[model samples]
Target: MKLHLKAALAAMLCTTMLAAAPLRADNEPAKAATKDTAAMAATAAKAPKSIDDANAWVVVGDVKGFIQKVGEVIGKVRPGTDTSQATTFLGVMLGNPTIGDLPAGSGVAMLILPNGDNIAFAELPEPKAEANAKPAGFALPSTRAEGLTIFGKTQASADAGKALAADVKAKLLGGKRTSSLHVTVPFGRILKEHDKDIRDGIADYIENVMKIQEAGRKMGQPPSVTTATARMLEGEFRVFHKLVSRIKTVEFDLDLTPDGIRTEALFIPEKPVAPKAAPGGQPTVSDAIKLISGQGAMRMAMEFNPEAITTFMEGDLMAVLTEMGLTKDDLGTALKWMKDWNACFGGAAAFDMFTPGSKAFGGQMIVRLRNPETALKMLESMPEMFKASGLTKLYEDMGAPVTIEFKKNAREIKGIPVHELRFNVQAGNVPNQLAASMKMWASGVYQIAAVDNWLLYLVGEGSMEEFIDAVKAKSNPGTAPLAAEKIFGAGGYFYTDYNIGAAMKMMQPALPDDPANAAAKAALQAMSDAMASAPPLLAAAFNDGGRHKVDVIVPLGFLEAVAAGAMKAAAAGNAKMDKAPATTSSATREKSPADQCAENLSKIDGAKEQWALDTSQKFGAEAKWDSLIGDDKYLKRMPVCPDGGVYTIGKVGEPPTCSIGKEKGHALKK
Candidate 1:
C-alpha cells in the first residue's frame, strides 16, 4: 500500500478523533481560567453513577497526558538498534512535541450503560502557540475559544426528542448543570483554516519517507507512488473540508433496546437551503422492498435515492474524478452504463440478501427491479458479453466452462414469478490439477425470476425452502424491513443484522484443533452459551450532513457475560500458575552454565544451520557474563573457550570461535 494510505489507516487505528483536527489556543490557562475546569467538574458530578457499571467506557479527554503516557510506555518497550519501520513511524508521531502540547479541556468520551443506553460527549480545546518548537511532519488545526455543543436523541418518540433538546439547551447553552448526554466540538472552523496544511503534510510524508518508498519498491511499486496516490485523494479532502468547515458542532444519540439500537439524524441546513421539488417530481424508494420478507439468521438491506445520488456523482464527483485523470469521455461512458443498468429496473432499486445459519451455510438475494422485460433482456445478453470480454476464456483456463441452464418454476418463492438459473463449473478439457481445484469451488448456481419488475436470485440449495416458507408467512423474520424507517429515512441507509454466535458455531467444524487456540476456543464456547438467550445484533450507517453516522445495537448482557468468562479464564490461569512447579530446566541442574554453553558451541561444526541461535539461547538462559568475557581468568575458565585465547562472537549466521596463537587448541573428537 502507499505510505499515505498506510498513514491514513494508522491514524484510524489510533482514533477517529484524527478526523477532527485540534483547534489552537494562544496561552496556558492561569488561576483565573476556571471555566474549563468547572465545566469538567460539573459534568463529572452530574454524570449518572450507573455509568461506572457500564460494560465499556471510552474516554478521549486530556490528550496531552494521554500522549505523554503513551510515549513513556513506548520509549520503555522500543527496540534499541533493531528498529522496524512500524516502530520508527510510531516514534515519529510520538516524538512530535505538539502532541504533548495539546491545550487543556480537549477530550471526548462515550460510555455504554447496562440498560442498553449510551452517552457520549466531546469537550475540545483550541490550540495555542508552541515553545521551543521544532519543525514537525504533521500539524493540527486550531479552534475558536467558544466551543460548540449539540445533542442526539435516539428514541423516535416526540417526548424523548423534546426532553433531550430541552436538557441540552439548559445545561450546555445556558451553562447550567444538567444530566443530558450532549456532545460538544468546534467542528467547522478547524478544518477550514488548516485544510491546506493537513493535505500538504500528508503528501510530504508519502513523498519523502525513504523507508516507505523503499517498501513500495520491494512490493513492486515505484517510489513517489504513495505521493501520487495522496494527490488523487486531495480532491476528496477538499470537498469534505468544504462541507465540514461549515458546521459548528455535531451530536449523536442512540436508543438501544432488546430489538436494536436506532437513531435519526435531522439535517437542519445552516449555510444554505435548496428548495424542495414538487411531490410528483420527488423520488421515492420501491415498495418491491417488501419482497425482502424472509426468515434467516443474517440480513442486510440497502435503499438509495437514485436521483439525488446521480446528481452528486455527475456534478461534484465527476469534477473530482476529472482532476484525478479520468477523461470526460471515460466519465460519460461510466455514467451511461449506470443509467442503462438503472433503466433495466426503472429508476429506483432496493436490495436484500441473507443467510440461513447452520453448517449448511445457504444464502440468497432478492433485487427490486422496475422493468422485468429490460432486466430479462439484459440477463440474456450476459453470456454473449462474457464470451466477448474473454471471461469465458478466463473461466476455461481455471478448468471450467461457465455453464448456465434455465428451469421454470424451480421452487416456490413468494411475491414473484421465478425461474432458476442453474450454473456450475464444467471441467471440459483442462489440466488435471486445474480440474482437481475446480472441484473445491462452491456451487455457482442461482435461482432467478422477474416478478413484477423485481428479480429474486437464490443461491445455495438447503435454505431455499426455508426462505420461501418465511416469505410466504408475510412477516419477514429478518431485521432489515422492520428497521425500514431507520434504514431509508435519511435520503438512504444500509443495514446488516446477524447472529454472531450462531455464525461462529457454524464455523466451528472448519476450525483447526490447534493447542494455541485452546483459550480462544474456550472463550468462544462460553460466549456461545451466553448468546443462547441473548438477542441478535443490528448495525447500520447513513449520511448526516457531510458526516457519516454509524449506529450499532448489540445485546445488553452479551459483553458482561464475555467479561465474566474472561475473568474466569484469568482466574484459572492464576490458579494454574500458583499450583504449577518450576520448570525442569530450572529445578534440576544437570550441568554448570559454562558446560551447557560449551556443549552448544561444540555442536556447531559448520554442518548445522542456525547454530549461532542455539548458542545464544543457551548462553542467555544459562549465564550473564556481560563484559567479563574479555578477562584472561574468565576466558581460561570458560568451557566454551578454555584455551585462554580471545573468544569472538559470530555474525548472525556464523558460529562463535576461539583463537589460540602460537599453540594448538583441543580438536573435536568427531
Candidate 2:
C-alpha cells in the first residue's frame, strides 16, 4: 500500500477510537471513563429507551435493493440502454475490504456528553474470516485497543449492537425497513461545549493569519494582496460560523423509492427565529408566493432574518474595507448607504423565470419593502457615493475597472416609478472573445420599479412591458398560487418549484443544428414529452416550531426521462466520434491577406474603444491614432494591414474601417 493510504487508514482508526472513548482530563483516562459513564447513565435514566435518547445517529438501509430498483427503472425508461456494467462496478466497489464486513441495514448511534465527549455504538454483520483480517500495511494502535470494539466478532459485542439497531428502527425509521440512509448531528450541543475554544481559534486566525493589527496603519497604504485576501476569508468564516452555531441539530435522510430517490434535511435551531414583520403587519412570504405561483417555468419565494443578516454584512464589509486601507470616516458614507438600502427592504422576496416566446428566458423579482422612497433615494445617491469613496480608483487598481450609472424614473408602469441601472466594464489584457462576452454582460440593463411599498425588478431578454404584463396576470385573483400545488401543500419560509419539462422545451431551439447533435435533440424531445404531465420538482424550507425542515421532491418520471436522455446522448456522442473527420493542424494553416487585414482592424477597434472610455468620450467623438496606438497606450503598436490598405480610425462609437473593400473580405464580419 502507498504511504498516503496507510496514513489515511491510521487516521480513520484514531478517529473511531476517539469517538468510542471520552475526552481525557489532564491525561487521566480512568477518570474520564468514570465521568462519562455517570453522565451517560443519568441521560439514559431521564429519557426513554429510544433513538431520540442518543445525541446523534446514522442508519443505512438495503444497498443491493436500491441498485436493483434503479436498474429496473432505467431499463423501462430506455430499453436499448445498457446499465449492467454500471451496477456491477458499484457492487465491486461496495464489496471492498474496508466496508464489506458491514451488514445491510447497518447503523451507528452516538451519545455526546455535555463536556464534548462522545461514545458510539455500531451494528455489524457476522464477521467473515477473510474480511475481518486487516489489510497489509494498515495497523491499529495497541494503546487504544480497549476503546475499539468490533461488533458481531463476539457474542457480547453482537448483543451490544442488536438493541441499538432495534431502537433506531422502531423510533427513527418508524418501523419501515425500506432502503434508505439517515444521519443526525446535534450541532448546537457540540458548539456550546467548545464555545471558548472555537472563539479563541477564530480570534487567533484573525490576528495571526489576517494580521488585523496592520489594519490601523495610515490610510492610503494598501495591504498586500495576500493579507487582504486573508482578511476577507476571515470575515466570511466568522459569519458562517455564527450561522452554524445557531443551528441546534441537522438531520439528513435519503430514501429509495420504486420511482426514484428522495432526500430531505432538517435544521433545528435552539430557539425559533422568525422574519421581521412587514409594514402594516402583512404576511410577506406567503403573499409573495401567492403573487407569482403559477406564472413561470420556475418560481422561488424566501424570507430572511433582516437583523441578523444586516449585522453580519456590517461587520464583514467594514473589515474588508478597512483592510483595503480605508479609514473609518471614509467608510461612513458607504456604510450608511448600505444600511439605508437594507432598511428599505422587508424580510421577504419572490422571484420567477419564464420563456417569453424566444430562445432566451426572462425573470422578475418582487421584494416587500417598508419604504420605496428610501430605496429610490439610495439608488439616486449611489454614483456620488462611489466617486467620493474612491471606489472607482480602487476597482482600477484591482484590475476590474467598471463604470456605474443609474437613470431614475426612466419610465412609469401603472403609475410606479421605474429606474434603470447600467454597468460598463473595461476589460484589460484578455482574449477578444472573452472581452466581447464581458461587454455583452456589462451592457445588460437592470430595471427596477417601486410599486406601493413593494419593489419589482426585471431582467433577461424579454421586453419590460412583457414582463410587467405577465406579472400582473399572475397576480390576478383567478390565477392559482404555487402554494396550491399539491407538492407544495406543506408551505415553508422558502419555496422553489422548477418545471423541468417546460424549461427543456424552451431550450430545445437553442441546441446546435449540426448532424452530430441530431440524436441528442431527438432524445431530449422524447424526454420532455414523457415528462410533460409530471409534477414539477419542488423544494421547500420552513420552520416547524424549533426545527427548520427542507423537503425536495423529484418525480420518478422526471428521473427516468433524464436517465433515458443521458444514455441516448452518450450513444450519439460515441457514434459521432467513430465517424469523425480528420482534424486540421493549426501550424499548417496560413492567414490570407484579407484575413490578416480583418485581424488588424479588430485590434484597432478594441484600442479605440479603450481610449474613448478612458478619456470619457461619447459617441461620434474624434479619436486620434497617436492616443490609441503606442507602446504606452491601449495598443503596443499600430496594426499594419497585410493587404497594404490604409486604416481609418472612426469616431468613438463606430467600428474602424479598412480601405480594402468588403468584396475582398478586408472588412470586419458583422
Candidate 3:
C-alpha cells in the first residue's frame, strides 16, 4: 500500500507540474515547441539531487535572480528610483562577513534527517579580495569548524553558528542543481516523535494559567467565572491537539513555469478514507457554478458535506456553547433546526461580488436546496429557535440589543414566494457616524427567494430586481456562466477566482483626487495597468482520492504589480522623509517626576484590567498586586512612583492613582 501510495503521489506531483506549462496555439511553429520542450527539460534537470535517508527538505532556486526580477519590476513602475542602495545594503549584510557573496542564480537548500536534525546551506560564490576592495567597516571572525567554513561579523555570532552546525551529520548537496522552491514535511514522524513534549508543553502552559486564575480568585475574582474559563480553555486545547495529531505529511511546491509561477500544496492523511457520496446524488453541473457570473470582481463556489459539518457543530460547537453557560437543552431546538436545514441543502453554495446597475459594490449568496419546503420551514422557525436559545439575553448583556423579524410570503417574485427578514441591532457607545452607517446598512430590505430549488439571498446596494435579472441571465442562453470560464473548468470541492485589476478599477473612482493622494493614485493606476494583461488569480481545493490538494496559480504580471506598488510607496516615503526637517532626540529627553508617576499609574490600571479580563471578573472586582503585577502575570513587574509617593490600583473598570494630587500632574487626565 505504501509503495502504491508513493507512486500515486509522484504521479499527482507530475500532473501539477505539467498543468503549469503554458498552452501553445495549434498553428505554433514546430521549432517553438522544440525550444519549449528543451527549456522544460533543462528546468527539471536543475532540481536538487535527493538526500539519503532524508525525512524532509526544502530547496529554493535562484534567490538572487528572484530579487533582481523584483528590482526590475520596481524600476519600471518608478523611474529614477535607486535600487542599487538596497542591493548594496543586502550585500553588506549577507556578504563576506556572513555567508559570503550571493550572486545571481544562487540556490539554497535545507535537509532534515529522520532524527529531526536539519542543516541549511546556500550555494554562495567565493568572496573577492582586492587591494582596493570596499571595506565592510567592521571586523569579522572567520573560522573552520566541524569541516565547515563559518563567518560572522562578531565572534559571538560565529560561535552560535558553529554550535548550530555541530549536530548536522549529513553531507550537504554540492552540485549544479536548482529549483524555484520545494518543501516537504514529515508531519507524521515529527508529531509522533515529539508528541509527549508537545502535550507536556501545553499541559504546563494550562497549569500556569490555572495557577494565575486561582491567584485572581484569591484576590476577589468570582469562582464561577474562573471555573467556566478554565473548562473552556481545556476543552478547546483538547480539540486542537486531536486535530494536530491526524496529519501524515504536507508538501508544497512553487515552480517558475513558462506561463508564470504555479504553487501546489498537498495534505495527506495518516490513513486513506474514501469520500462519502453527495446527498441527493451529484449533479452534472454544480448549482453554484450555474448561478455564478464570470463578470464578477470576485467569485467563490463550494460543495460541502452537511452531515460531516453538522457532526462537528453538534459535538465541538455544542461543547463550546455549554462551556459558555448554555445547556444542551437550551440549544436543542436550534441544533435540530440547523441539522434539518443542512439536510435540505443540495451540497453547493456560491457567492459573487460585482457592481450592479446602481454601480456600487454588491454581492449575493445562492444555496442549492434538495428540499425547498423543508428549508423554508426551518428558515421560518429560526426566529422562534433563536428566541428560545437565550442568545437575546446574551446580546442584551453585551450592550447590543438584537431583534429578528421574518415576514413570510411577503411578496411574489416571478410566481415564487419571496420572504423578507429584518435583523435590527441597537449598539451602544459607538461613534455617531458609525452608528448612522450601521443603521443605514441594517435598514436595507433583506430579501430571500427560492428560484428553481436555489435559495437566493441578496445584500448590499443592489436592488432585488437587479439580482433577479442576474439570476435570469444565467439561464438566458446568452450570458456565460462562471463555470464556462477556463479557470473554473478544473472541477474541485472549492474554487475561487479574483480579478485584482477589476476590483481596483471599481474602487479607483471612489478615491479623492488630492495632492496628498497623487502618488497613491499613480501607483494604483500602474498596478491596474500591469494586471490588465494578467490572468485572474485562481485557487482551488480538491479531495482527490483520499488526499486533499490545493493549487494556487499566480501570473508573473501580478507579482510584478505587487512589487511595483511596494516600491512606489517606499519612494514616496523617502521623498517625504527627505523634505521633513530633522527633529530633536526624544529618547534622550527627561520626563518630569509627576509625568513618570502618572505613567506608572496608567500602567497599573492597564494591568488591573488585563487581570480582570483573564479571570472573567465583572466590574468593581478587586485586583491584588501579586495577581496583576508579577513577572508571569499581566505586568512584567510592578510600577514604582517616581516620587516617594505610593500608588493604588483601584477596582476593575476604575483607574489607578498616585499619592500626589491631580494638581501636580500625577494623575491621568479625564
Candidate 4:
C-alpha cells in the first residue's frame, strides 16, 4: 500500500473545548490585567473531584507542583521531555531561575486541549475521603495560549509568555471548591505557520509543562462515527456534511457522579472487522482472501470464525456474471469443468490467468466469437444452446452481455484456449440498445475457439481477426465450445491490454463506426470508466458476490460489461486454481490468538448457523437466490438441473431457470 497506514492511523487533535467556568465569565467577558494571586485563586477553586473522572477536570497548580504531585502518585513524568517542560516556564515566571518547588496545587498548573481534538485520558479517581470536591466526572482543558511566543529575547517579552500561561491556568480551572484535578490534552506543542516560530514556541511550552499522565486508556469499540477527509491540506479537511457515518447510533447515559450533567462521551469504534469466512468445506474462503490481498491468514483458525467471515467470500459471482451480461446459463456454458480437478471445485484453471487472480486468491474468464455476424447468427440459429444455456434469456432481459471476470489471469501454458463461441451470421435484429451494449469485440475470438466440444473456450492474447487462423491450427475433432477460460482471464480491465486495446481501437472508428457506431462507443466508454475506477482493493475482492470487494455498500448493479469472453474465461478456470501455503514465513499470525478464540463459535454453533440459514432463507426469496448463491457447487457450476427438481426459470431449455421461482418470477428470453 503506497499510503503508509501508520501515518494515517496517527490520530488528529482539533479544537476540542472543555468548559471551564472562569470568572463565571460570558463569552464577551471584559479583559482584566494579569495577576498572580487571581490566577492562584482560580487554580485552587476548580481542582478535579477525582482522577478516574478526569475528562471533565483540568489539572491545575504550578508546573513544578503539578509535576511533584503526579510524581508522588504515578511516578516521575516520563523523563526526557517532562523535566525540561517545567524549567522553560520558570525562566519566564521568575526570570533566570529553574522553578522546581515542593508540591502545592496552585500557580500555572493546568493546560487543556478539550472537546473534539480526538484524545482523552481516563485517570483513576483519587481515594474518596481526602478531598471535598464532588466524587467524579470527565473534563477537557485548553493547552494552547494565544500570546505565548518563545523567541522573545527581551525580559519583558519573556514575562508575557509567563502571563499567557497564567491566563490559561485560570481559565482552565472550573469553579468548584477544592480537590485535585488533572487536565486532559496538555498544551505541549504549538502549530505555527513559521517553522522557526513553531520550534521555539514548543520548546518554551514544554519547558512550562504541568504534567499529569498523558495517553489515556483507549478501550475498543466500533468506530460509530467515521470521518473521511482529504488530507491534501494541513489542519484543514473537508468533512462530510453528515457527521456520523457508516453505523447506526443512539445516545444513552450511565451515572458517573454528577458534576452537574457534564456531557458524556460515547463513540462506537470501527465496525467489527470485515468478515473473514464461514464454515462450508475445506480451507476457508476468508483465509483465501486475506492471503490474496496479501494478508496472512491461517485457514485452520479462520474456518472456525464463521460469523467473522460472513461477508468474506471474495467474489460476487452473480454480480460478476451479471456485469458480464450473462445469466446462470451463460456461466454454465462458459465453465471448463474438469471432474478430476476437484480441488478447483471441478474448476480447470489457475487464478493467475488474469492480472489480479492467482492460485490461492481466486480468478475469472470470458468468451468471444470470431465473427460478430456469425456469432449473432449462431445466437439466432441455435436458440437451444442459448435457451438451454439460459444465456439467451439473460441477454434479452438485461439487454446486455456484460460480466466481470476478475482474478489474476493464470493461463501461461501454450496451446490451451480460454474462451469460445459460435457465430450468428444472421444478426438477429438485436435492438440498437442491446447491440451497442453487447459489443466488446469478443465475438471474433469465440468463433476461433469453438472448434472442440470439450473445449469450452480458447485462451489467447492474439487478435480476434486471427481467431479463424487459430481454429485452422486447432487439431481437435470434438465439435463444441472449448473450455479455455484460463487463457482469456489473461489480464485486467478488458481495455488494459495492448492486443485488446489496439484491436478495439483499430475498430473504434469503424465500430459504432459512423453514426450508428457512435452511440455504442459512448455507452461502452461510460461502462468502462465506471468499472475501471473502482477501488483497486475491490478488483482483488471479486468473489461469489460483489459485496466482498467494495467498501461502499453496492447492490448487484455493481457489475457491468467490460466483462464478456474474458469473464467466462476466468470463471471457467476458477476451481482449477491451486496455491501452495506460504512456507518459512515470518508474518504467520501466532496460533496463540487462534487458540484464545477456539470456543467462540462452539458456544453458539447451532444458533449462528441457524441464523445464517434463516437469514439466507428470508433474503433468499428476494435475492434471486438461484443465481446469487455461490456456495452451492451445483448452482455455481450448473445453473440448471436435469432432474427438474430445483426450479425452472430459464428460457425453454436453459438449465431449468435462473430464478428460484420466489421473487422476480422467471426471466426468460422474450
Candidate 5:
C-alpha cells in the first residue's frame, strides 16, 4: 500500500521466459534515447512529492521573535564540532519545509560568531501572512537535548602564578616567578587551545554523523542534500543564520528521550557555487539527451520516471532477496534499512556511487562535497598513507569501480553546471535487487552533490538494448530491436525511482510561473532536470555486471542463460559435421613381364640386361627425392641406401640442418 519500491519490483523482472522477441530484419534503424515519450515526460514534469509534504511546515513570514528564545537555549548547547544540532535542524526541516507562511520581499534572519558558527531563522517577505505555525514532530521547546550534562569552565591561574614575585613565591611555596604577567603567555589561550575538552567536543560531530548515518539507513539513501542550520532569533528583524552549504548525512533520535527530537547533520564545507554557462541556442530534450547519450559508444538515454520505479520497494525486503540471489546473511549488520536509508537520503540530493576504484566504497566517511569534484578529490588524495598512490591507483583500489564519460546534455540553467554523465560502473548482476537488499551497495539521491559530468552511459552486456528502445520510441525510428528491449536496453546509472522521489521533494513548492515571478521561476527551473530511470532491462545489466552494447544489450543472467543454451545447441550441431569420407583416389600399378623374365634372361643377353638395370637405377633415384620431402634441399645430396633410409651427417657443434637419414630408425639409449 505504501508505494514501496521493493514490493513492486517482484512483478516486473527485466528478464523472463516470455517468447524471445525477434530483431528487425529490415535496414539498420537508428535509435534515439530521447526523453520525449509522452508517458515518461509527464512523470518528469510532475514527479511524485512526499506523502505528507503538503501539510509539512512552511516558514514564510518573520518568525524571528519565536526563534530568538529558542536560540538562547540552543546556543547554550556548545555543539562545537558536534553534529547533533546539525542533525536536529536537518530533521526538523526534512519533517517539514514550511515554517509559517509569509508574503513577498522578506529574508531569513542571521548572525555570525567569532568561532564562525551562527544561527539562522526565517521571516518571509511581506504582504501575505499566516499564523498557526503548527510545528510538527517533536516540537523544539517541548523537547530537550539528549544526554545533556552540566558543563563547567576551569579558572586560568597560569598567568597569575607566573606574575608573582620571588618573595611571594618563597612565602607561598619557595618557587620563583621570573617573568612579568604582561610578557608571559596568556593562560586562557593555553586552557582552550588543544585542551582535552576541545578534542572531546569532536564527539559531537561524530555522534551527529552516526545519527544521520542511522537515519540514512532508515530512509532510502537517495541523493539527499543536507545543510546544518541553527535556527535562532537574532535582534528583532533578523534571524541569525549559519548553514553548511552541503550536508553529507542526517539522522534523528526520537526514541532516546522518546520525547526529544535529536537530529544529527554532517555537512560539506561550502564552496562557491559553479558558474553556469551563458545562454546559447536552445535545444529540445531529445537533442540534449542525444548530445549526452550519443551513439551506442557514448549515449545518455535519460528519463525522469518516479511512479514506474517506486513499484520496486515492497514487502519485508528479505522476501525480495530470495528472488535476487541473496539471503538474510547478505545484509550483514544492517538488517533494517527502512530506518537507516530513510534518514540518510530523505532530503535534497541523496547520492550513492557505484564507481569502480574509489574510496567512496570501503569505509563510511560519507563525504558529500559541494560538488562531485570535491568528493572525487578527497578520495583521490586519501591514499597518502601508502608509499605512493596517484589518482589512477586510487580509482583502482575503490570498492566500486567507476570511469566517467561526460557529454554536453542540458543548457546551463541560469549559469549553473548541468552536464550529462555516464559512469562505467562495475556493479553486480541485477543491481535493483541488490539495491533493495544490499545497504552498502544501495545509493540514493540524499548523499548526492551536483554531478558536473556523466549524463549518459553504458555498463555490462545488453544494457544498451533498453535505451535503444526508449530512443527508438521517442524518435520513432522505422526499425526497433525488440519491444521488451525497447523499453529497457542500455544500462548505466541514472536516477532511481526513489531518487526521483527525492528530486521531487527538493523540487517541491513549484512557484507559479508568471511575469512577476520570472526570477523565482528561473531558480526553480535551474534546480530541476527532467531525468528518468534507464529501462529496467538496461538498469538490471549494470546491476547484473554484464556487458551491454546498444542493440545487443543483455543482462548478465540473459547472457549466461543464452550461453548455456548455445553451448547445448553447438554440441548438437557438432554431431552433424562428423559424417565425412575417410579417404580418396582409385588407381592401380602392374609389374612389367620383361622384369620378371630378366633374371633368366641375364645369362643370355648382357648388353640388354645392363641397359635395363641402368633405366631402373635412374627411375629409382628421381622418385626417391619426390617421395620423401616433395622438394630438394642441400641435404638431398646424401646418397640413398637399400634400407629405406637416406644418411647425411653434420657436426654436432654446427647446428644440424634438417635431413632424412638413410637407416632403419631404432630407439636411442639415453
Candidate 6:
C-alpha cells in the first residue's frame, strides 16, 4: 500500500511544477484500429517493448528534466527571470540529504501483470566505482559546449522557430541532440531503488511536530484534534509497516472505458501464507441477511467475511505477532475474544445520511449469535472490553466520555424481537460563549434496537419509524446502492447523490454579508451556477478476488466552467490594456491594508522610535522598523497613523491623517 503512494507523490510533483497532460505509453496501441493500423503494427514490430500484454502501464516524467525545459522557455520569453528558486525548492522537498543523491534524467515506466509486476525502472546517471568505498546515489549529469547549440550556422535561416529550437536544445538538453538515462527493466525485476533515507527524514519531521505539540500542551494550549490524530497515526504506522513488510508481491490492473476507469490492486503474502479457513466456518451470510430498502441521498454498507479475517489473524498474523514479541497465550486470548465478538455481530453493517440539511440517519447491523440471550450477553461485555483497552483515555482527553447503556425492554420489528441500546457523545469540547453567540442547537434522541440477529440504530423520528415500518412491511431493498450492487455485490458499498445547487443555497446564510466581499460572493455564485448542471460526485471501493478496487467519477462540466472563467478574466485584462491607460508608478498603485497602515505610520512624529518600542514587545527589543520597511529612503519607516482619526489602524476607505495628538492607536487587538 505504501508503494502505491508513488502515483500520488508523482502526480503532486508533476502538477506542482507544470500542468502536463497525462502521459500515454509510447508503445501502447489505440483501443480501436483506424487508418493508421498498418503503420502502428509496423512500428510495433520494430519497437523493443509493448504495453498490449500488460495489465497496467504508467508513464511518468522526470521533475528535474521538466524544470530544466521550463527554465529554458522562460529564459527565452522573459530574460533575467532566474529559475534557480524552482530548482532549489524541488531539491528541498525531495532531495536525499546524502551527497550525490540526485535522480537521473526524466521518464519512468511501470507495468503490472498477474504473475509478476514490473514497477519503476528509474534511469540513473553513470556510476562512481571504487572498491572498499560506500555505495552512492544518483546525481545530475553535466555537459559542456554551452553556447554551441544555441548559435546556428551563418547560412542557416535565422527564423524565430529555428532559433528557439536551437536555444532549447543547447540550454535544456545539454547541447546533445538526444537525451537518455540508459534505464530499462523487464518483467519479474524489482528496482528496490527508492530512497529510504528520504522516508526516514519525513518520519523524523513528524516526530519533531509531535514534540512541538507536547510543548504547546505544556504551555496551557489544548492539543488540536488534527495534531492529536497525527501523533496517534505516527505511532500506529510503526506496527502497520511491520505487518505490511510480510507482503512480498503486489500487482494492479487498470481498464479504461468510455465512461470511466476501473482499477484493482492485489497484495500477495510471502511464502507459507496464512490459511483461509477457520476451525469451523459459521453459517454464511448469503441466506441469513435480509435485504432492506435504502433511504436518503447517501448510503454506506460494509459486509465482512468473518471466517477469512479470523483464519488469517489466527495463522500467519499470529505468527508475525509472536515474532514481534507477543506471547502465544496473549495472542490466543485476543483471537478468541475477536472470534466471540464476530460470532455475535459481524456479517454486515449499513448506514445512511439523508439529503443536505436533513437530519435523518439510520443503519442496520448483523448480530448472529447462538441465540438472543447470548447476543445480549455479548453486547453487555462490549463496553468492558473497550474500557479495558484504555481507549476511553483518548475520549477523556478530548473532553468527552465514552458511554454505553442498554435496556431489556423488548419489541418486534419485521418479525424480529428487538431490544434497545443507547449511547451519548458530547457534541465536542466547545466554549459556552461560542455556542450561545452562534445560537447553535444541539440535542437529539439517538436510538438503537436489536432484532433477532440484527442490531438497528436510528436518528430522527421519521427515518427511524420509516425503517422499522419498511422492515415490517418487507419493502426494504437492502443496503447496497442499486447500481453498485452490480459491481461489488453486497461487500462494502457507498453511494451519494445530492443537488449541489440546493446544498449551496442552504449554506448561503452562513456566509458574511459585508459589501466589501460582494465581488467574491458574486464569483462564488457564478461557480454555483456552473455546478448546477453537473452530476453529483460519486466514489466507491470494493474487494474482488483478493484485489481492492476503488472508483471515483466526477463530471468535467464543472472544471470546464472554471477554465472558461479564467480565460475570460485573462481576455478582459488584455482588453483593458488595449483601452489606452498610461502605466502608473509604484507610488500611485493601490496599496493593501497593511501597506496603507505602514504609510500612515511613517508620517507620524517620532514614528521610527515609537514603532521600535511597540514592535519590540512582540518581536524582541533588537527589532528595527527600518529593517522591515526596506532601503527606499522615502518610505523607509513603517507608517503610524494618529489615534482617533477617521484613519484608524484597521479602518478602510481613504488614507487617514497622522497626528502627534494621542499615544499610538489603542494597541491593535488580536
- Candidate maximizing TM-score: 3
Q: Write the per-residue lDDT of candidate 2 for residues 358-472, one digit (tens) a residue.
A: 3334566778777878788887787788877666665564445778889998988776567997766776644444555555445456788765566777765545664455455
Report the C-alpha displacement of residue 178, candidate 1, in angstroms.
Answer: 5.6
Displacement of the residue 156 alpha carbon in candidate 1, Å:
43
TM-score of each: 0.46, 0.58, 0.59, 0.21, 0.18, 0.47
Query: In model 4, how large is the Cα lDDT of residue 17?
Result: 26
lDDT of 5: 0.25
| Candidate 5 runs further than 4 Å off | 1-274, 278-456, 459-670
Per-candidate count of clashing residue pairs (backbone under 3 Å)? 14, 1, 1, 143, 157, 12
Candidates 1 and 2 compared: the better one by TM-score is 2
Task: Please write out the lDDT profile of model 5 over residues 425-531, one tens digit for every residue.
Answer: 44343223232333332222111113222222223222233333433343323222322223434332232211221232233233332232344444333323222
Higher-scoring candidate on TM-score, 1 or 4: 1
lDDT winner between 1 and 2, please give it: 2
Q: Which stretches of candidate 3 lie over 4 Å from their true place?
A: 1-56, 61-107, 111-118, 122-178, 188-244, 255-262, 277-287, 293-297, 313-331, 354-362, 429-444, 463-489, 499-537, 553-670
Tens digits of per-residue lDDT for model 4, 1-670: 1122211111111112223322223442222424643553454344332222122234333334433333322111122223333433332232222223323333332223111112122111221233223222211221224322211222332233343443343454323322333333211111111223333333332221211001000111112111111011111211111122222222222111111111222223224233334334433222122221111111111112322222221234334344334465544643312111121121111111222211111122222222333433343334354455444444433334423222222232245332333332222344343364344233323222332221123222323323333334431122221111122232111111111221232333334343323345554444444444321211111222211211111112222223332353344333223222333113223323222122121212222223323332221122233433355422332233222324432221112232233233332222
Ranking by lDDT: 3, 2, 1, 6, 4, 5
lDDT of 4 at 22: 29
Q: Which candidate is the best by lDDT?
A: 3
Count of backbone collisions within predicted model 3 = 1
Model 1: lDDT equals 0.44
lDDT of 2 at 32: 25
Writing each residue's lDDT as its tens digit, candidate 3 over 354-439 gives 54431334567788778988888877877787777656664454345668888999998667777987777786633333454455
The sequence of per-residue lDDT tens digits that candidate 6 reaches over residues 1-670 is 2222333343434332222111223342223444444453454333123333333344334545544544443443344656645544433333222212445444333333222222222232332343114223211111212221111111121121132333333333332321212111222222121124323533654554454334335434356643655555554554455455554445543332223333444555454343234225543333223333343444445556666667767775666555445565744544566787666665545554443444323333333344556666766676665565444555566555556556554566555545555555553543333233232222233455555445555554344455565444434654444444444355432333333444444344434553323444555555555555554444556544443445544334433444554555455444544553344323425544444444454343233333433222221123233434554543353443323334332111112234433244322211
